[model samples]
Target chain A: MRVTYHAVYLFLAAMLSTTLFTALKLFGVSPNLFIIYIVFAGFYVSKTEAIWLGLVFGFVYDIIVGANVGLNGVLYMFACFLVVVSCENVIRRNNAVVTFIFTAVWTAVLEGINAIFGPVSGVWPAIRIIIVEIFYNGALAVILYLALKRIFERLYDNEKR
Target chain B: MRKLFGNRIFVLLLTITISVSVVLGVINATKTKSTFMGNVAMVVITPLSDACTWVGRKVSGFFGYFGDIDELREENEKLKSEKKELEAKIRKSEGTDRENKDLRALLELSEAYPSLELVSAEVISRSASNWYESFIIDKGTADGLKIGQGVISGENVLLGRISDLGSTWARVTVLTDSGHSVSAKVIRSGDLGIVEGDLSLSKDGQCRLSFISKNSDIVVGDYLETSGLGGVYPKGIEIGKVIEIKPEVQGISQYAIVETSAEIETISKVMIITNNPAESTAVGEE
Candidate 1:
């Protein structure tokens, strides 16, 4: 089998997610980088590819982090599929604002789905945590997306030349 | 029909991944011994986690180096003064040690119980993401730790249990985690209740005791300890204290907010109970 650049990108994304998770946890914050990467991949990659990346990342995440087995896989796959289906109609743009909004919405949806699976006490506090996490992760997503966009755009331009 | 079959490779990969994961889950759930998988997981994840932690520490240190020199000097002086005071205390403590040697000796008292064996280990890694609640310890099966072993810190305060045991590492699920539960008793009133976890309560570094009797005279300051009823943990290990007791409006039970004695975030050394009578009985009697 031919080794693909997509596989390399996915691996790099997983490693980046690990670093981001550790960094955020040090600051007493929890940011879902796997979810963010999956959403970003869904927007940029094919639906099938997005789902595959999500599953790979989710399984690696589950093994490293002990969560309810298959929970992250299911959540990531569903989230990526949703984003991929939605982004097909939406035109691709280099707008940071759009990326910010998408990140916030994605984070909120992921947290909402997680709350449904787990025992969440006091809805208001849970909602507050979800909002704070969304804002934190949304800001992170903006920075990461801008950087990756520039890099990928440069590479594509070079390839064309 | 063409569109349906367009993503056949992806669908096939997804099917295989899900099937394999399901099989792994079933095997994990049924297998009584978690040593093999636990070892493999430790070998795979620990080095990565350690490297991440190292990078985090380096980054934090790099940022911290930009602090004002005056502030740093002041902090240094304060630490020196505190060290001097500690040194004086140590000297004085040695002189008066003979008179009150046995007083408030929790460790010695804990040693009187033959069913308990303690193996100390350091917390090497904490949970990486917010989704999971677990910690990895430095010592593992090589240190006499096995799956289902109870862990405690700071004067026998219950931390969690060893959920996964490897050859040289283990994973501990803290009592503040949503997935953990323990059969606990009110130390003051001798009332039995179940201690469940709320990850939200972890902000205040506390756990919750649920299913407490409404009629039970559990005051705000009442102590809570393990009941040893579940055969998981030994009896009389301090868990926490009742900080708030709210009787449920509908049920005959009250809910308690317990402030854990062990500082979960700051704890470095933990003792794993290896020779509990309950565990031995469960294994031998079975």
Candidate 2:
């Protein structure tokens, strides 16, 4: 029995989301990991799949942590759609540096929009948080990309046999 | 135009999905039961959260044991000195015995309320995903804990409410959560306002108090306590201290920084305040 790409994607997404959540709690930080997952989805999954995943994750997030319902779902869906559509012109490459840069940019954009429209207080402090979080998550994305790329390549090679 | 419409199935599907989600979201926003889904989702995620907390605790415990011996000793010494100072103050107060007798009378000034039936519980789990802000307590419905019950630290500081209660466990939404807010008052001055948690502020182990009047005489180190206006929390429980106050810009209400009394990282025992004021009053009358 071979694991499909979709299955791998789902597993990775869940793993990344859970890991990010646990890590944040352990360290008392709250950066958006769903946005990072959405970025990863945009790069790996088809546009249709990415949209659905975005909506599902967003709805789940809203149900989990949102003060008011639908706020996070709406934002997440829009962010996923934007990332998927925008990445259409860019050549697909799975390099660590590239993934890091893309994740950082997307994370910043999502956080920036949330800062403006989300329920954050004290916008000036939020700006500083965004900068530090972008750097932290950017470094994490680079490490994650390299590790995942190796794993995927090995899986692909095993499938050839 | 026909070809464009035919080829836009993905776009069309996306539109339908977004619309349905928005409509569902809107319905959730309008109803009190919107929290139902959140509670259910928390139940589904509890096991994962438990595992993560277990791992996190072990890791922290391992490192903390090695790192904090000297610091702990220093803190112990300071606490000893402070205890001695407090003892001296107690001895110096000539009316201390009379004041002890008047303690219950002062509590009655806030309006006689029910004596709470508190069940102590330990935090057994914390959030495992970035999406939810929750922790699991060992006590649950079996322990007479109920949803909407208030959880308090040892110092009577408000922690959060029990959002989901199961047979053997319950999930608590910490006050430091982004969605949490409590009606609070300055304990010394009776100045009423709201204390809210900002995700960003949590980074520094603090929360924000907003909507205070510009003229309110709040200063650093003023004690904040629950106002009991919302019926969710009891009055006179210590919440935090005012660490910083920023005046509102151009006629806006003032905001203050609060360092929460309960250490978010090191909480071990918490009490569930199960009695509502009416029930508390009934018990008091009895």
Candidate 3:
């Protein structure tokens, strides 16, 4: 049941990445909704659930973005692993600061990988884009956290039954 | 062993991810088209993507289309008036004989390429990043769209080409993506160069004509057309015009910035050329 729910969620994420996200440009960037979801799962869900979500959605992201097929899959799964492993013992109490740090670190690791592997002309230009994107993602995270929390709260309550 | 078996899903996921990553890396290095995986991804993802794009275009187009339609109508009127005025002068020159010859020539030019039968499709989604420029069209392999087929806007305007394909959807990488490059010529001077999308200029609907020879008699306001050298895009399709020229040295031009004719940002509809003259003949024989 949980897998089905997440599979539907993953498909919806792909749809958003391709269509609605194209129009929702701010600071020349839209929030990486999948990444946000991964971070949320890492913080709020079980370790296995988080890993599975990251792996599946990361692969989906790569296919939809139409870049190299496995780049995002590997990178996103690793991001989730790092976040979950790091935060599991550390940030169990404080939701706000932990979410901020996790989101920022996730953005940094992914964007950093992107800059190195990206087909840009120079590292500085890549760095510039990455920094702007990271900030945009950071700002968007605040808005999504509570809404995501509420939505997942219901999801959790249903699963409990 | 039992605990490890239970925990080993993560191990299995990581192993699969790494293996796929290496395989994809090799594929990227070799530049092989993803005939299998690409088709699968498109087949699975495109219908959903297309539905979303359809809703997005209609929802957004519902309100935005009114203003856009009016502006386009005005532009269309001005162009029609200019063409009518030209036709009137031509009619006065040699009566029906000259017009008949011109019409025949126009027909022959279209026949020269062979794939005059175009399939119209609505754009469902555009690449959502500055790093890429591609869109999903509502037609696919089922519609006979092949990889590397030419995509166009109007009758003679160059848009891009179909880059990837599925059964029901195709992805078009427009001319403005930094990764996109096409062979083209300056219509006025006959100077040839590869027009590539510049990442910086693409944001404003522009690309750059690169590797232009030094001795070319090129200047601003010169129009460009596809040279058809790559065999991907059709020949003589209007691409854009030179807006600025940057000189390499004395008596040598390095490159010129060409503004694309297609308003790719706001464009919502496009056509794909599924059959070239050769393919049409092959089909005719079959």
Best by lDDT: 3
Output the TM-score of candidate 1: 0.73
Please write out the lDDT profile of model 3 over residues B179-235, one tens digit for every residue: 788999898888899999865676567988988887789899999988767767656
Pairs of residues clashing in candidate 2: A21-B130, B114-B280, B114-B281
For each candidate, C-alpha RMSD in Å?
7.3, 8.3, 8.5
DockQ, structure candidate 3: 0.31
TM-score of each: 0.73, 0.70, 0.77
Tens digits of lDDT, candidate 2, A62-157: 544434456556656666765655566454555677678877887777667545544465666667767766876777777677656655456445
Best by DockQ: 3
- Model 2 chain B: weakest 10-residue lDDT segment is B104-113
For model 2, residues B1-286, the per-residue Cα lDDT tens digits are 3443454754575476457556655674454332556655655555555555556655655565556779967876887777977755654673454334334333442233337666777676555333235666777777887778888765566788887666667878778766688999997777889998787776556888989998788889999988777888766667899999998676767999999887666564677887784355322233
Clashing residue pairs, backbone N/CA/C < 3 A, model 3 = B114-B277
Candidate 2 vs. true structure, TM-score? 0.70
Task: Assess each model's interface with DockQ, reporting 2 decimals per model.
Answer: 0.22, 0.23, 0.31
Q: How do the residues A1-161 of candidate 1 rate in per-residue lDDT, one tens digit apiece?
A: 11254455555544444443443342345676676667665666667666776766676656556544455676577567657656665635535676678778988876776665545666865676688778887887888887656655554453210
**Local error of candidate 3 at B148, Å?**
1.3
Best-to-worst order by lDDT is: 3, 1, 2
Write down the worst ten-residue block by lDDT for model 3 chain A: A152-161
Name the candidate, 2 or 3, with the larger TM-score value.
3
